[model samples]
Target: MSSTSIIKVQVDDTQFKSFLDLYQEYQEHLESAPDDWKKVGDAIGDAGADMEDFADASKASKEFLLIAATQSEIISREIRKASAANNALLESLTKNVTAQKSFADQAERSEKHMKELKKGASEFAHEIFGLGSFLMRLGALGGSLAGLGGLLSGIGLKDLASSAVDTQRSARGLGMTPGQLTAFNQDFGTRYLDPGVLGSISSAQSSFSGRMWLARAAGENMGQVAGEDPGQLAANLAIRAHNWWVNTPASMRTAEVLQSTGFTQSGFNLNLMKQLGNTPLAELQRAAAQYGSDQGRFNVSDRNTDAWYGFLRQIKDAGNFIETHLTNKLSDLAGPLQHFADAVGKDVTVLIDQIFTPANLNALEDGINGFTKYLGSSQFQQDMKDFAGLVAAVAGAMRKAARFLGIDTSPSSSTNPASIPVNPGLDPDEVQRETRGQVRGYGGVSFADKALGYTRHKLNMPSDPRAVLAEMDAKNGLPAGTLEAMWAKESSEGKNLVGPVLRNGDQAIGDLQFTGAAWKDWGKGGDRWNFMDEAKSGGAYMGFLSKRYQGDIAKALAAYDWGRNVDKTIAQNGANWQKGLPAESMDYIKIAKILNSQKQNVRVTVQNSTAARVAVQIMRPQPNEHFYRLSVSV
Candidate 1:
């Protein structure tokens, strides 16, 4: 109970050892996204379904209008040609009313059918007036209707003046002023996405479908469910109604909104659904939800359908397309991860259960002693010999990933740096400068540590450029993480394989984006297609630049971007060399500050003088490496 004590720790849990254990547990696998994400997918899907229905109805109404107009014109032409008495005869034939009169009746029927079609279509469109974001997505195909963009299409929309009048009349029926409808339509998507609307909107029941669902949920007559209501049905209300329709644990998956909540948007999946033309909506949704897992769409009979469930099924169908690259990505890693585990002599088996360090190395332990004792052992020698092929395998995977991003990979062949064809384009004077020593390839025990560190720290990359980046920085005597952060800013850590490939300027590729000319000179010995090799070549070049600039990071980076032209830039700006650099080069220097923080190494307390020791490590122990311990205390 001393108040002056330096540290006082409170235990929240009796068995808690370290916070890292909790972090490792939670970080083990990807978990389900929050309910808010699911709701977003629901909003998109449900609104899309409404728009799809409206699109179908609008299309039908216009077709009827076009045909009716064509019929009217034909009748008028015939009437002009007819004699007065024959016109009466023609009317008698059409009805036994004349043929012209009968045709006129058909036109009237068509007009009536057009209005009916527009009426139903208006209801769906009006309901979806609350989902403007989904409408914008549809507008990618045809412009948004809110701004009369759909009304202005040069494509097949024949009755603009009449449709506008009908829309105005429908707005009046919904008790919304023209101005209010525009304002309401503009903000519907936002309202649907908000959870707070649930309490207030539940009391304001509106549309027939909304009324029907409310009636069913409360066991009341559909006629009586209309409480002072708004005509628009929000996404949340539809979801609530679906839950009410199917509330049981065993059957909730059969609910419409539950089926609809997934990533595939309507526009993205249109062609997919068209492929299975006339496939049942239930079957399509069921197949799509099964891609990642069976999130069930149509297991129950059609009798389970709620009144508004038809639109909900279409919403779920949109989500069924499920465009994702995660499965392929995971499959790509299975081989590399397994091979690496095997290469490490099985001591690295089962992550989270063991502290994984690369074994069979020449590294000294216990500290830094008996180094290279393992190198003499025959087993350890085989590991070293096998390493070249392992490196090739990992490099091959990196190459594959690079190719996936459409990078024209640089070739890896010539081993000797001297054989690299000289680039006459490089500043000949700078090329001749002292490099201090030959550039080092990451081989030996140090490489093993770095590669394993990448797997432990960064996840899933077959090889991380950061490790290579660190070595590249060191070659120039630049700080560790300096190049890594710059590359992160440059090419998003090599996710962007090539830049300016399409531009009619200097083509660039890989993380550092060494131009074809630059690669020819500085990168001749390395594979521009391979990230690690690209880093080494790029780092060496930057090192050359660093020496020329007297270790001024800004000067070195500016020169890297501007090339030989940076000298002219420096000459122009005089003392303010930074202002002379391009906007991008100045932006590149900002990450140096970012990487500076990364280079601020966190010093951990290490016990050096031994208080305890062990005879064996109990790992896949090498013949001479029997002196492994769990921990040595000082």
Candidate 2:
């Protein structure tokens, strides 16, 4: 620990070089030495033990030990300093490494941006060149047009050209050749002259000349008509002209002919005068006057019958055209068009039937039938059937169409359901009673009269039985004590008869009375049981009574009695009762209730035999002659 102690150490060039090299190397090693600290510490610890083991040696060992101790001390101090320097260098190096990575990432992003810019520039250049090529083609076409001197040779352009320096001015004065004028005239004539219009036109020469001028004007402005062959244009134009003449108004016909022939308004007037000077204005005026007079009164009524006949002829002709010319010509487009034809055919059939009267309807039917046979002979039976059904549907639609047209014939009822007979006046009750008796008799009842009698007797009873019994008397055709007497009879029977017989009798009586009440009330005035009305009103009442008794026997019997009475009444009065109360309506509610209750009761009885047995055993204990609360909780 003394600062005065001289520690001898050997040093030479190699050692000094080693020391200098090692010093620099040590600086580097120190920078990385934190990685090796644990190994360095272990070596230092071993050296201290080696120094102690040599203590047993002589004076020479003592001298060596002193040098070794000083050397160890110096080495240990250097190791500690190197360890601190190495840690500091390592921390600095980590910061430099992170900074380098950040720079590299920024460089990569800049490189990617440059690549996208280059791609965009390449596309912009390509579009510019493509536009340049299109402009060059247009420029070349213009130059070629300017060089066409041969085509303009016949026009005496040099003389006119001096007077009109501009090319447009010179071209405007040019005239068409005789052939061209004639071709123009023919084209306009065909276009404007439909058969009907041609038939009406006066001053034929003027009409023809006007048409010629109009065609020339149209050709000059619109180019030759599109979609027409050069050779066929003349023929097509002639047909078109004929159609125009047929359809055009008298005043407008001459003007349309002039316009189609290419004449200006002034030119048309001059040409018309030249063409028709010999025809006399009075004759033309007379013809026009006749046409004008017919305008409002114009009707095809005189020819309507013939027109319809002709219409049928036209339909047949068109159908034939479709099957022959069109089908063959447009074989590829035929499938869908054929389907359309079938639809149109069906619609046509319907139109005919609707427009025609019943007397005339048979003609339409015959036409349709004939068409069907035609279709059947071809490969379109399915198509025909579909068309026929559609036509049948439209038969009614034609009535609406006829109405719109102001035709006043009766609407055809070919497809309507058969009409029912009208009922004359008759007693509904008698009719219903007779009908009921018949139904009962059919069901093996021997006494039809007895059945009717029983039904009638039950019908007269009041709905509130207690009220009825309370008010009963000989005056009302019942004994004063009749109910009391009946009650006594019932009690006696209850004691003597088995449970089943008593219950059955009670059920039969209740059912009979319920049905009789329903039937009697069905047609009675003032809230009486109209079977139809009761059907709607009685739903809740029926449900309540069914749930109250925990059974539907009373409801079923009520329905049966109603059904029987209605049937008897219908048979007795026939058509008369049919008008009053429909026999079907009478039976409807009753039958439905009976069947529904039967199913429900059968299921209930099967599922709960005990309930069924109890119901059968207990006689529904006769409802008291006087109204009393009968409480039973389910």
Candidate 3:
């Protein structure tokens, strides 16, 4: 471009380019604007064209403004609708969260209830077993009150079964012969309901039920098998197998054990029996492996022989027992039998798929709820009160008979073995005669008084020395009655009472008979061998032994008898700790175990029909080492 003319042309070109840029910017704005705004812009442009064509420009522009206002209102309405939809969604989400929390709370409460029910069931089972045994024993002894059986029946164990099974059904299931069923009803019914056996069954049930609840709570399968309380079935089978084995001739039993392990010890035999009694599934399997195929015991091919006939008879007897007690035509008793079995066995889990099926759990829940209501009822409490009064009446009648016979059943009457009532009543026939003989005999009182005074003072023990020992047991974590029995063996209540002096002439002294050497180190001082000193030192030593031997009571007691340096004594004694002990020491532990187990408790009172108080005395039997007895009135 030229200088003057070219400069003018260039400036015009630059202005044209700026105009093009503004046009491009306007087009871009039109493309990006809202559809409604574009419509408004188009109407405005049309209004402008109309104004350009017509005379009223103000009216046309007013019309265009009205259109734009209408478009703006539509856009505002749409925004408001979207906002309302979002608010509704937020509200729905909030409600859902609250509902979830409520559901979670309900679940938590359900779990807690289940836990409590399981615990309660276990405790109830234990008490029921104990009470049942007590009542059954009384019945067996011909002293059972009519109401005791009624009380157990009221608990309604029979109502739990709904699988169309009973004793009759069970017999059919087992394919039992009619003769076998008849025989079983006679023999098995008498034996199966024994108090001790019932106690074991109750224990098994508690274990099984507890495991079931625990597994369900953990969201795990309760048992490995279907259709059986595996624990109980195994235990029952094991028990039967053992009983059968044990009943065989001694030689046969010996051969079986030898075949299983090549060598045997008493401990091993005891352990084996215990295993059979406990009857874990694994143990059951092992028993089956060892004994399942043995036809020698069961062989009936030689029917003419006495042994063969006896074996057949025994089999028939056992079959009868099972058919009569555990099986029937109406309902299979297998379920109930298994229930009892599981109660006695260890490591029992509930048969979740079997006993704790949905239907059964529901029934249990209902039963528990109903029982809870019954317990709260006044009539139930009244029945318990009535039962207690009846027991008192029976006890009173017996006591009257005892007193008329002039038997001094008092706590302080005997000292060699403390007189405690084993069962308070007009003593059993044998006991009554013995008590009468003792009364007619001379010098029994004189001997007891002299021994009691010295022994009571020396031990710093109560008139009821056993009670004092029991208290010590609670305070020091010793098993009940262990220390008292130990004392009894050491001093026979401080002087061998009626027996010849049993001292080994080692100058042992005090209730526990600490040797001079041990007394020097532990009994405060050698010369000061007193009851308080002996107890403190002995307890500490026992604690040491417990820690060292991992609470094996037998081993600890053996070491105690062997003297100090228990480890050295154990080393010298080899495997049998009792080998080198003096006869008295050996005898001491043996007697101690028995004496410690002696339980004589009496809770009796006399109240007349007129509600007048009569003589109230509680007596326990004072049993000597030979279980010779004297009665005590407390």
User: Cα lDDT of all candidates, in order?
Assistant: 0.50, 0.41, 0.49
On the 0 to 100 scale, the lDDT of residue 135 in model 3 is: 41
lDDT leader: 1
Query: At residue 481, what lDDT does model 3 achieve?
Result: 68
lDDT of 2 by residue, 1-634 (tens): 6688579886667767777887898799789877689789889989887776665556677899999999999999999999999999999999999999999999899889989989998898676455445446646754554444334333433333332232222122222222222233332333322222221221221355543443453342222332222222333333333334445555665654655454332133323333333344444343334333332232233234344445446645755764575346456645655665686699899997878788677987999998877776755877675566556545545545656776543522323222322133322222222222122211122133233323443455445543344344222222233333332232231121111111111111221122333434432332222222222223323333334433433332232333334345446776564343445344433433433343322212323434433222212333211112334333
Q: Candidate 3: lDDT of 440?
A: 24
lDDT of 2 at 550: 37
For model 1, what is the error of residue 325's alpha carbon versus the real structure, in angstroms, after optimal superposition?
54
**RMSD (CA, Å), each prediction:** 56.1, 39.4, 41.6
Ranked by lDDT from best down, the candidates are 1, 3, 2
**Which one wins on TM-score?**
1
Weakest lDDT window of 10 consecutive positions for candidate 2: 498-507
> Which should have the higher TM-score, number 1 or number 3?
1
